[model samples]
Structures are given as C-alpha cells and as structure tokens.
Target chain A: MPILEAKNLTYTYSIGSPFEKTAVDHIDLSIAEGEFVGVIGHTGSGKSTLMQMMNGLLQPTSGQILLDGCDIWDKKTDRRNIRFQVGLVFQYPEYQLFEETVYQDIAFGPKNMKLSEAEIDRRVRETAEAVGLTEEQLKKAPYALSGGQKRRAAIAGVMAMEPRVLILDEPTAGLDPKGRTKILTQLQAFHKRTGCTILLVSHSMEDVARYASKLLVLSQAKVVCYDTPTGVFAQSQSLESMGLALPQITRIFKQLAEKGISFEDEVYTVKYGAELLKTRLEGRNPEC
Target chain B: MLKDITLGQYFPMNSVVHRMDARYKIVITLIYLVMLFWGQQIWSLAAGLIFTATAVFCSKIPPKMIIKSIKPIVPILIFTGLINLLMLDGGDVYWKWWVIRITEEGVQTSVFMIVRICLLIAGTSLLTYTTSPIVLTDAIESLLSPMKKLKMPVHELAMMMTIALRFIPTLIEETSKIMAAQKARGADLESGSIVQRAQALVPILIPLFVSAFRRAEELALAMECRCYHGGEGRTRLRKLQSGLRDYIALAITLLMFAGVIVLNAVLH
Candidate 1:
C-alpha cells in the first residue's frame, strides 16, 4: 500500500470572488513506502498546494488523502496524528525558528507528541546527529546560528518526530552549492537509514534527477507527467516547450548520444560521469 | 473565510466616477455627509436620499456591494436605533409595558437615526469602491500638500498609508502560510479553547513577525539602492483634472444641499 495517496484533489483560492483561481486541479498521486518522489513545476504550478494537502494542513476542495489505507480526513482519524506521521519542512524553514535554544527547538515535535522526557531527549540527539549538528551547537540559540545551521536545526525538528513520510519544499533554495549538496546528501542518507518515504518539491532538475527515483511534473495546475526520472527526462522536448529544461548531465549525455557516443548506463551524477569517462579512457590507452 | 474582506479592495473599470479626481470626490463626499446630517423634515430627507442614490447609480458600483459594506455596522445601527426608541421621553406615550414606554417622539428619533447612519456609510463606501487606494492616497496627499508648509509631514503620512495598504494583503497571505506550516507540525489551531487557540497563534505570530521585519529591512535596502529620497521631487503620472463631470458632480451636491435647506426652512 502507498504511504500517502491523493485522489482527485483540487484546491481553489478566493472562491466565490472575482479574483478566484484554481491552484490544483484534480491531481491524483500515490507515494509508496521508501520511495523518494520529486515534484517539479514552474512557479505557481500548485506544487506547494499539493504538498500541504498530503499532511492535512490544507483541506482539499474535493477528494481524499489516504495514509496507510485510511483516509487522513476521516472524522474518526485524528488530523494531528496524521501531521505527526507525515512531516513537512516548508521553504526557508529557518525563518520558522523561535525557541531560545536549538535543542528545545529540535525537541518541539517529540514533546508535542507527548513522549517521555528520556524518549524526547533520545530523539532530539538522534536527529541532531542525523543532520550533522554538534552537541555544543544544540546549547546555543537558533537565531544566533549561521543560516545553514539554522536550516539544519529546522530540518532536525521535523526528523525528531520520526515520521514515516517526509515532505520538503525546496530544501536547498538560496544555498551555496556545497551547502545544497550537504543537505541533499544528508536527506538521502536519512531516507536510506530509516527507509521512510520522502517527497521533495524542487524546480532544479539536476537535484531531482540525482535524489529522486520517481518524478512528477506539473504545469498550469495539472500533472503533465508522472514516471521515473529517466522516463520524465527522456521527454526533454515536451518539458522545454513548457518552459522547463532537463538536468544538465542529461542534456550533455543526450548530445553525446546524438554524436554516436552511447554509453552502457545513464549518468546523472558527477561521480557516475567520471566513472564512465575513466572506463572509456582505459579502453583507449591501457598502459597509461 | 478571510477571503470575504473587501476593505480597500480596488475594482478596475473605465467609468466616469472612476475617472474623476479623487480629491474632488473626497470633498464632494464631505459635502454630501454634511448635507445628510443637515437634513430635517420628510422633504429634506427625501432630497438627500435622491442625491445619494443618483451618485450611487452614476458610480457604476454594484448596488449589492454597497449593501455588503453596510452589513458589518448593522449591529451598531440597530443598537443606536433601539436605544433611541427606548429612551426618548418627551412625546405622548403610545404603549407602556413593564416600565418600557413606546412614544411617538421615540419612534421618530429611531427612524431618523437609522436613516442618518445608513446614508453616512453608504456614501463613503461608494468613494472607496470607485477609487483605488494608490489614487486615493495620492489625492489625499495632494489635497494636504498645503499643510506641508506647516511641517505636517503630509508626504510621509501618505507614504506610510501607501506602504500599509500595499502590505496588508501580502502579510495576510504570509500569515496564512505560517498558520499552515504550524498546523502541519501538529499545532491544533481550530477546535481548541479560546486560550489554547490564542496560544496556538504564537507559532504563527513569531514567524510572521520575523518575515515582516525581514521584508522591511529588504525594502529599506532596495529603496536606498534606488536613491529614493521621499516625495521631494516626485511627479505624478496621472495629474488630477477637474473636467465637466467634476463640475456637474459638485453642482448637484450643492444644489441638493440647498434644496434640502430650503425645504427644511419652508416646512418647519
């Protein structure tokens, strides 16, 4: 069964008014356990609106959100419990930090879950370790930390809840390349270590290509395509027509293929590209 | 539910009222209010109503929108009318029950008070509905430009109002986003005790306040980068012009007020 499922979800803003707009229109999505799904779209394509609906933060205009074979919006189901089970880290989450100490901020979710003191401490420490935060760093105020640290602390706050499903909206936005890679690597490691389902909403095709196994493309408030990253990237012409582009590596590889230099495997990451080049070079000059 | 708020809402249209000088509209509105209050006797009240109703028609604003604007203050209107009805004791009593007396004077005073308040609100709403906030503030600043010689800070006041009006919807949107973010973390904002709900707002308020400060700092930097130095040498793109329609509007307002005054004198 899927960890999270949205069936025919729709959201309309400013309904019954002259400025009314339909943001998300009848989107159907199903995310299975341990799957990292990447959502890509142009700005105002309703990606954030769909993310908010999955965890019950937004009630859909019509349709249902089912988690673990039960409707998340069921009257018998506790909406808050669904929230705890599905963690969401909004864009620029560092702006949401308000607690005096990093440790207290990270422990907020576990505390709200009514866990025991020792359990909360254990979860907080584990989350801090997962996000590469030092014990001393936890003692300081969140506002006093550097921007990257603040972001990690905010992500750790969601991780401490131990949710089975995690949704991140532009986790690497406004970050340096090193910082972006660090956060994405840490998220990938967390997914691998805990086997949790993850949904990442991003506009960067390269980031989505490297990190997500499945891909969903949105355009004009509708799902244009939903498939594996390779399948989605193969339709580069259609994506470009919609004012979008494929990952940088994918474009390079496609050019190489057009020039009659096909490789055995598709290379999406720098490491994979380097490996492919090394093998080709060894075949040309074995002594060197 | 916050979507229903139409305060300061600008409707874009190409009507005669929308094209008039906002400063003149403001002056005419003041004159209309003065005449409404100056009205006495049935003929004077009827004349005032006819003038207001005609402006309402020429403004091209939907009649229902004016009704919605008057909807919010209904409670206060009802309260004032009821108080007048219950308290006036000069005229002959029509009915008495349990120390509550209904008198002819009380009834007349209640109806007059209701009409006065209704006309007052309806007249102002027409101005707002027809004029955009930027135009309105610019008109106000222009009208008050003479006070700048008295060190009244008219430019700064108008600038502040413009900034506030621009940010109201942006901040409302930011607040809703913050509220959703907090709610996603198991923060129960709804279905809570009043105190609990107020407490739940802390999570939202902190982020909203932080973003507001961030926006202000960014705006300051942007203004400095653009060499902004207040309204010292600013020129308007659309200069306020007093055309034939403006003259006609003013004449009608004055003639209506004069006719009411004459009727009040003759009838009394």
Candidate 2:
C-alpha cells in the first residue's frame, strides 16, 4: 500500500464568507514508500495546505487521507499517533525551537512519543549525529548556535521520532546556498540510512531535480502532473505555463535539442548533463 | 478559529461611515459609549439601540459580521445578567428556587444591563469596522497632540499602539503556526487536564515570545536605517482633516445623545 494517499482531498478557508478561498481543491495522490518525492508549486498553489493534511493536522473538508491504506480521519484512528508516524517540519523550522538546550529540543519528539529516557537520549544523539550536530553544539542553547546549526538541531528533533514518512515544507528557505546544500545533503544521508519516505516541498526546481526520485506538480490548487524527474522535465512547455520552470541545466539541454543536438535521455541535473555533452562532443569530433 | 473574530476587524467598504474622518468617528464612539451607560430608563436605552442599529446600517457591514463581533462577549454578558437576576433584592418576586429568587425588578434590570452591554460592544465595534487601524492611530495622535506641550510621550505612545495593532494579526498567525508545528510532533494540545493543557502551552508561548522579540529587533533596525528619530516634525500620509461628512456625523451623534437625555428625563 502507498504510505500516504489522498482521495479527492479538498480544503476551503473561510467557508460561507466573502473571502472564502479553496486552497486545495479535489487533489488525489498515491505516494509509494521509501521514495523521495518533491512537491513543487508557485505561491498559493496549495503545497503547504496539502502537507498539513497529510499528517492529520487538518481534517479534509470532504474526502479523506489514507495512511497505510487506513483512513486517517476515521473515528478509530488516533490523530496524535498518526502525527508521530508522519513528521512534518514546517517552513522556518528553526523558529519552532524553544528548549534551553539543543539536546532537549532534539529529544522533544521522542519524549512526546512516551519513549523511555534512555531510548530518547539514544535517538536524540543518533539523529544529532546524522544531522551533523556535534556534542559541544548539542550542549549549548539553541539560540546560541549559528543559523545553520539551529536549523540542523530543529530537523534533528523531527528525525529523532523515526517517523516512517517525513514531510518538510521549504526546509531550506532563507538560507545561504552553502547552508541549503548542507541541510539537503544531511537529509539525503538520513533517508539513505533509515530508508524513510521524504516529501520535500520546495520552489527551487534545481534542488528537487537533483534529490527527488519523483516530482509532483501542483498549479492553481490542482494537480498538473506526477512523474519521474525526467518525465516532468520533458513537459517543460506546460510547466512554464503553470508558472514553473525546468531546472537551468535541463532548459539549456532543451535549447540544445531544439538546435538539432539530440540527447538520448532528458537532462535534469548538472552532473548528468555534463556526461551527455562530453559523449556527444567526443562522438562528433572526428566528423567535424 | 481565531480568525473568525470580527471584533476590531476592519471591513473595507466605500460607505459614508467609512469615509467620515476617523477623529470624528473616535469622538462619536466615545460619546456613543457614554450615552449607552448614562441613562437608567429603558426608553433612554432604546435611543442607544436605535443609534447603534442606524450606525450598523450606514456602515454597510453585514449583520452577520456585527453578530460575530458580539459572540466573544456573550459569556460576560450572561454572567452579569445572572448576577443581576439572582442577587438583586426586590419587592415583587416572580420565581424562587432554593437561594435563587427571580424578582420583577431583577428581570427588568437584567434585560436592561444586557442591552446596555450589547450596545456598548456593538457601538465600539462599528467604529473599528468602519475605521482602519492606521487611520485610528493618526486620529489618536492628533487628538493627543495637546499633551505634547506637557512633555508627555504622546507620539511614542501612538507609535507603540500602531505597532501593536499592526503586529496583532501577524502574532496570531505566528502563534497558530507554532501550535501546528508542535502538534505535528505529537504534542497533544487538546483533551488534557487543566494543568497539562497549560503545560502544553509552554512550547507555543516560548516560540511566540522569541519570534516576537526577533521581529521587534528587526523593526527597530529597519526604522533606524530609514532615519527614524522619534515623532518630531513627522508628517503623515493620511492627514486627519474634518470634512463636511465628519461634521454631519458629529451632528447626528449630538442629536442621538440629546434624544437619549430627553428620553431619560421624561421616562425616569
């Protein structure tokens, strides 16, 4: 069964008022486990609203979300338990850090799960190591840490819960490029080590193209497409019309293909694009 | 759920009440509050009811929204009404139930008190619904300008109020975000004992306080960057000039107060 599935999901803000808005309208999705999925949309495309519904933070106005083929909104389900199973790191997760020490903050999720003290400690230390927080850093207050370190500490708080599926909404927002890459790489390593399903909501096409195995596109509160990164990149024309774009390297590759230099595969990442260009150049050198 | 509050929420409509100078609206509201409480007779209180109903109509705000503004204060209204109903000793008793006796005067006073409270709330809410906060701030500063000669920090106080009013929605949004984040981590905010629920609020309050301080610091730095130095020689984009509409509004408020006074004198 898919780890998370939304069946005709819908959310309307301020119903029956003049300012009523349908933030997420009739979205249906089935996401398999252990795959890093990227959700992309422009501002007000319902990305954040959908993420909140995934973990039972919000009850659907109509329809339902199924986690492990069980209706999450069912009366028999404990919504709090579903939260532990599917952790969500909101945008600006660092602002959610409030504990005096980084270690205590990282242990918050495990503590809430009613785990024993020793187990909570072990999970906190393990996730801290995974997120690249040192022992010295963990001993200090969260506010005392640098911006990147504080963010790492906050992410570790969710990681310590060992959730089967983790959803992060714009995790790398408001960070320098180096900080962004460090956080993403650590998240990648955590996924590899734990085999946890990750759904990353981001506006940056390049980051998602590089990290996500599957890409889900939302436009104007509706799903436009859900496909592999390469397949989605191939629909660049339609995506652009939706106020989204292909990654820079993929756009460059598309331009080259239009100029009669065809690539066998859709080029998305810079690494793969370099290899494709090198092979094409080497093959055409003798003819030139 | 917090966003449903219509109290102090401005409704943007191009009606005559909305176009009236905000200073005039403020004075009218103060007078409205005074008139709501000054009279003891039911007929005098009817004047306040008629005035509030008329103001609500002229503002073009929906009746449903006006009802929403009164929702939050219902508990207080009920408490006061009950105190008046059971506690007052009167000559004629209607019903008696073990220590709680409903007297004729009790019913009369309870109804009168409830109506007064409702009119008081509805009258002030109409002012907020019609006047935007920034304009309200400007009106307050202009009204308090006389205190500037006495070395009072009138400008600073008004600036503080403007900032506070501006940040209320932002802070509420931030609070809801923090609460949701904590809930996603299995923090059970609902269905706990009284103490446990209060404990759950710690996570929310700490983060809210931290973010509020950060925002304050950033605002201070930004204000400094723009060469902000107190309120001296500061001109406003929206000048509070009393126009023909304002004077007309003032006349209507004066007439309402006069009507209430005449009703009290004749009826009481």
Candidate 3:
C-alpha cells in the first residue's frame, strides 16, 4: 500500500473572487513507502499547492488525502501528528530559521512534539550530523552561517522530527553547484539511512533524473504524467509543450539518434551518457 | 485563508468611474462623506442614498465586493445602532424596561445613524474599487503638494504610503509561507491555549520580520541604484488631467451636496 495517497484532490485559491484559480485540480496519485518521487512543473503549475496538501498544511477543496490508509482530514485524526509524520521543507527554507543557535533551531520540531529533552537533544544532534553540520557550526546562530550551511541547518530542523515521509520543495534552489551537490548528496544519504519516502519538487530535470525513482509532472493545475523517470522522460515532447524541458543529456542523446547515430534515447544523466558512449566506442574500436 | 482580506484592494474594470481623474474621485468622495454626515433629515438621507447608489451603479464593481468591504465593520455598525436605539431619551416611549428604553426618537436616531454609516462605507468603497492604490497615492500627493511649501514632506509621506500599500500583498504572501513552514514542522497553532498559540507565533513572526526587513533593505538599495532621490521635481509617467467627464462628475457631486444641505435646513 502507498504511504500517502491523494484521491481526486482539488484546491482552489481565492474562490468566488475575480482572481479565483484552481491551483490543483483533481490530482490523484499514490506514493508508496520508501519511494523518492520528484514533482516537476512550470512556475504557477500548482506543484507547491499539491505538496502542501499531501501533509495537511493546506486542506483540499474537494477530495481526501489518505496517509497510512486513513483519511488525514477525518474528524478523529490528530492533524498535528500528521505534520510530524510527513515533514515538508519549503524552498529557501533557510529563511525560516529563527532560533538563536542552529542547535536550538534544529530541536524546534522535536520540542514541538513535546518530546523529552534528552530525546530532543539526540534527534537534533543526529539530524545536524546527517545534514553535515559540524558541532561548532551548530552552536552559532543560523544567520551567522554561510548560505549553504544555513540551508542545511534549516533542513535539519525538519529532519529532526524524523518524519516518515519527507517532502522538500526545491531543496537545492539558489545554491552554487558544489552547495547543490552537497545538499542533495546529504539528503540522499539521509533518506537511505532512514528508509524514508521523499518527494523532491525540483525544476532541474537533470537532478530529478539522477535522484528520483519516480517523476510526477504537473501542468496547468493537472497531472500530465506520473511514472518512472525513464517512462516520464520518454514523453519529452509533451513536457516541452508545457514549457518544461528534458534533461540535457537525454536531449543530446535524442539529437544523436535523430542524426542517424544509433544510441539509446533513454540516457538522462551525464554519467549514464558517458557510459553508453564508452561502450559504443569500445564496440567500434575493438583494438583499444 | 489569509487571501480573503480585500481591504484597500482595487477591482479593475473599464467604466466612467474608473476612467475619471483620481483627484476628482477623491474630491467627490470627500464631498459625499461630508453630505452623509451633514444631512439630518429624511430627504437629505434619501438624497445621499440616491447619490451613493448611482455611484455604485456607474462604477461597474460587483455588489459583492462592496459588501465585502463593509463586512469587517459590521460589528461597529451594530454597536452604534444599539447605542442609539437604547440611549436617547426625549420622545414617546414605545417599550420600557429596567435600564433599557426604546423611544420614538431613539428608533428614529438609530435608523438614521445606521443608514448614514452604511452610505458612508458604500461611497468610500466605491472610490477604492474604481481607483488603484498607486493612482490614489498620486492623487493624494498632487492634492497635498501645496503643503510642501510649509515643509510638510508631502512627497515622502506619499512615497511611504505607496510603498506600504505595495508591500501589503507581498507581506501577506510571506506571512502565509512562513506559517506553512512552521506548521509543517509540527508547530500547532490552532488547538493550543492562548499563551501557547501566542508562543507558536514566535516561529512564524521572527522569520516574517527578518524577511520583511531584508526586502525593505533590498528595495531601498534598488531605488538608490535607479537614482531615486525623493520627489524633488520628479516627473510622473501618467499625468493626472481632469477631462469633461471629471467636471461633470464633480458638478453632480457638488449639486448633490448642495441639495442635501438645503433639504436639511428646510426640513429641520
């Protein structure tokens, strides 16, 4: 069974006003346990709205969100507990940091859960380490840290809750290449270590291709595609029509195929493209 | 959920009211407000009502939007009505109770106050619905330019108002984002006690304040980069010029106010 399921979920903004807009329209999808699902869309395509509904931050206008086979909006359910079970780290979450020390900031979530001090300490330290923040850096204020460090610290604030389903919206946005790689690598490691389901909302097709097991494409408040990375990227033409592009490596391989060069069109990442090219070259030059 | 606030919000539509000079609209609205308060008799109130209804009809703004602008002040309206209904003492008693009296004069005064207040709100809301905030600020600055000779800092005041008006939507959006972020971190803001709820706001408020300051600083720097040094001889992109329609609207407004004053004097 899926860990989280959104059934015919619809959310409208400013309903009954001139600016009324259907941000997410009847989006039906299920996220299984331990799956890294990447949500991609053009700006204003309702990716953020959909993510907010998954964890009960924003209520759906006309549908249900089921977590662990139970409706999250049910009257008997404790909505606050759902937030702990499903953590969401928003885009540029570093701006949400407010505690005097990064260590205290990370503990904010666990403390909100009313956990014991010792347990909060353990979770905070563990999450800080998981996000690659050193003990020295954890003692300083979040604003005192570098941009990448602040981002990691802010992410740790959510991770300390040890949520079963972690959702990150543009986790690596506004980061340098090295910072992006470091944050994504740490997130991947954290997911692996905890075996938690992650929904990564990203604009980079390459990042989604390299990390996400499944891809969900949103266009104009509707789900255009939701499938495995290879399966979704196969519909590159449709994605492009929606103002989204395929990964650069996949586009290069597609161009190569169009030029009569026989190569796999499914190559999405540079590493995979290099491997494919290396194999093809070895096949052509058998002497070397 | 925070998006429901429509205070000072403009509704864009092409109509005579929208096309009129902002200065004229401001002046006419002020005249209408003065008439609403100055008018004491039923004929004056009827005239005020007719003028407001005509303005609303011409603005082309939906009635629902105008009603929404009044929704927030319904409490004040009700309180004023109740006070007037119970407090006034010099007429034939209709109903009497311990510490409470409803007299003919009280009933008449209450009805008059309520109607005047409603007309006041409807007239002012029509002005906002027809005029955008930027244009309204421009009108205010132009009208107050004469005060600049007295060192009133008219340009600075208008600039501040314009910036504040511009940032209301931005700050609201930021506030909602911060609230969502904190809520996602298991911060319970709804079910907590009064103190707990107030405490929960810390996480959201600190972040909101930080971002607001950051945005203000960035805006200041951007303005400086563009060579903005206040409104000293600064020219405008869209000049405010009164046309024939504006004159006609002003004439109608003046005539309504004069008629109301005349009726009030004769009837009273």
lDDT per residue (tens digit) for residues B63-172 in model 2: 88889878989999999999998888887988988988999889998999999888888888888888998889889988988999999999999999899988988998
True contacts kept of 2: 0.77
Docking class of 3: medium
Kindly report the fnat of each predicted structure, to 2 decimals: 0.60, 0.77, 0.88
Residues B1-268, candidate 3: write the lDDT tens digits: 7876765778999999999999999999899889888988888889888888788888888888878778978999899999999889877999988988899999999999989888888888898888999999999999999999999999999999999999998999899889889889987878768998899899999999999999999999999999999999799989999999999989988998888888877877
Clash list (residue pairs), candidate 1: none
* Model 2, residue pairs in steric clash: none
Model 2 chain A: weakest 10-residue lDDT segment is A279-288
Candidate 2 runs further than 4 Å off = A282-288, B31-56, B61-122, B251-268
Off by over 4 Å in 1: A14-21, A285-288, B89-104, B262-268
Error of 2 at B4 (Å): 2.3
Instruction: State the displacement of the C-alpha of residue A183, model 2, in Å, after optimal TM-score superposition.
Output: 1.6
Best candidate, DockQ: 2
Q: How well is candidate 3 docked (DockQ)?
A: 0.73
- Candidate 3 interface RMSD (Å): 0.7
Ranking by lDDT: 3, 2, 1
> Ten-residue segment with the worst summed lDDT in candidate 3 chain A?
A257-266
Count clashing residue pairs per candidate.
0, 0, 0
What does the lDDT come to for candidate 1?
0.87
